[model samples]
Target: MKHRKLISLAIVPILVATFIATTATLSLAGSSINPRLYGSDRYETSTAIANQFSNQTVSNVVLASGNDFPDALSASVLAHELSAPILLVDRNTQTSKAALDYIQAHLRPQGTVYITGGTSVIGSNFESLLSNQGHQIKRLGGSDLYDTNELIVNELNSTSDTVYIASGQNFPDALAISSFASQTNSPILLTQTNGLPKGAQEYLTNNEPKNIYIAGGTAVVSGSVENEIKSISPNSKITRFAGQTRFDTASLAYSQLAANPKTIYIASGLNYPDALSGTILAALNGDPILLIDPSTPLVPDSIAMYLAQLYKNGATPNVTALGGSVVVPDEVINNVVNLLNGQSQSPLFNITTVDSRLNFGGLPVNLLPNKTIGSTLTLTNTTIPIAVFIRR
Candidate 1:
């Protein structure tokens, strides 16, 4: 008791807890991640935002470094990429000499469908394709207007039901972007996949977007991009498409777009568009496009559900024994078929939407909840050929 004044006190636990709490709070507030840097200063500005809010580092960025951010008119163009008007041709139909013959046959007076767009060389080549096709589509933009506010009052009036085709990088100078939010007073910079122009920036000053795809490719984000348009828009409609290396397969990408569609989003090759698995799946939207090739199990949710529902009585294929990079269980393969046809097998039993939990100890732990079968798609043809477009 004489040494009470000199007691060592056990406040260590409290201090440790305080420190951890502080650290966690700060991390939750915001932590930056380095993405593969690409494009001009405006693009760099967008990269800086990614660094501030993300938690990953990019060792290698793919797209070339160039200043592609839009000016006023260009910003108007970016705003235009809200909802895409995609016209998909079936692979079977596409391969038919008749299909190519049809497209070549339908090449309008100057008919060329621009498939992609960003803030770089996509402009000239884009114009050429459309022009060569006999169409005269001109970008109505100036410079530095990623938000489409400028285009709202001025542009939309001119484009009525006009399919503004853009591919391989676009976002015309943001006089104002107008592809979406036709009724928003000043055209609330509505980009489900990317950021809006300046006005959208002002509108989204304190809000998040419906969806924001932060890729380091041609569709790179612009300067202070998030702050510029996140608030002006809505998060429920926003979709951020980051953590991608490139757009490889037609099948994978189609799934993504179906999950979240957009007019202005990042893609792998703008010049050479890939075949979309969705195109085929669309054919069977109301029917079943079964992938019964025991060699390759059907994974697309739409297709899987169709298969599951088609075989409520268990007539689905036996693809659990296929040899590939995957090792699927038998019941799962069968269940997938049942679920696909709109039949109700425990909704929780959807192996197609669950994680392949593998634990080192006892049984694997599933860390996520179940998912709902949203939509259906069909693949009329399994095999598709790559079609290359030559801009004359």
Candidate 2:
């Protein structure tokens, strides 16, 4: 009996180990590769993002104006909700050649393709062209940007306590936060800097979203407009996230809105094409997109600081540069890579006048905020984790 019990115990351990190995394999199968989806231009870039899900079967797809901003800003929520990708189509060309080819190759024989905006923005024949290709078409748009925004919001099956608001005149703020908005199912509404857009006002009047997050500072969205928002929903709380520049604002958004993003997409702040497509890809991967200028000599200060802080906290995030060399450039990529590899540039000068400080009797520095200075202070570890390197 003792011999049999010993044999059973050995067999049980082997069985448990085999089960764990099998479970791990199954879990890993669901997680896929993180690819930098891009193309020659905006049209192709959007196609590349859609191709990421090509292997899987989807019943629907969403189309938005490639040349404009307002329609696409409000389309992300519906796109995410429907498990659809937002493809950019030229208003005059109807659909770009690259997009049509991608659809024919990757997303054919699907149930429907919902196109946003009316015929004026997308051309009247665009719908018919898709219909002729055997793709069932549904168009969503209104007479103006405000009306279209309202129309888009109404399509949502439900709403959350939070909503995101950005200027309709531009695309940066909206693109930067699209992934977070989609993930949280928060509706993004467009507003003028000085006042609220009609669609935004209408949506607030109809549905109550208690928490509203405003992207960009007063320059992009003015104080008067903020007051109007307060008047609309007096009880609702408002939060603003902005920085010295658009790139800073994007980094701030990623830092505050996302929780330890495992991956981040770096795109040009000067252009819209790369980021427009990149946003959808980032959202799909459950990541955030940080903006940077490819033309700059070094990574912008705010972005570098944010990345340094992230690295200091023990995060090894996957960094992807969107667009080709022309859009993001090699120097920018090198700077970001060096940061991730912990090969940051050395400081300009450290303790230049150490003897001078000794001769003058160095004073105890109180770096701690809001602390009253005292005669004696304890000094812990003296090493600073981060140092700023300045170029002369």
**lDDT (CA) for every model shown?**
0.27, 0.67
Residues 1-392, candidate 2, lDDT per residue (tens digit)? 21111111111111111110000011111123243567877888777777764546666778788777777777887888787777788875544887667666656584578777877777868677778878888778898886787787878875578889998888888878888887777888888879898778877877768889899989999999889988998888888888888878877887787546666677877766667666666776557777776545367777777777766666666667677655665445556655655557322112221111111124633222233333343434443222211111
lDDT of 1 by residue, 223-261 (tens): 345444334444434333332323222222233433222
Query: Which whole-number lDDT from 0 to 100 does residue 329 have in model 1?
Result: 28
For candidate 1, what is the lDDT? Answer: 0.27
Question: What are the clash counts of all predictions, listed in order?
Answer: 86, 0
Off by over 4 Å in 2: 1-35, 93-95, 108-110, 345-392
Q: What count of clashes does model 1 give?
A: 86
Any runs in candidate 1 off by more than 4 Å, and if so which?
1-103, 110-133, 139-199, 202-337, 342-392
lDDT of 1 at 216: 27
C-alpha lDDT (0 to 100) for residue 109 of candidate 2: 82
TM-score of each: 0.27, 0.75
The local lDDT score (0 to 100) that residue 376 gets in candidate 2 is 46
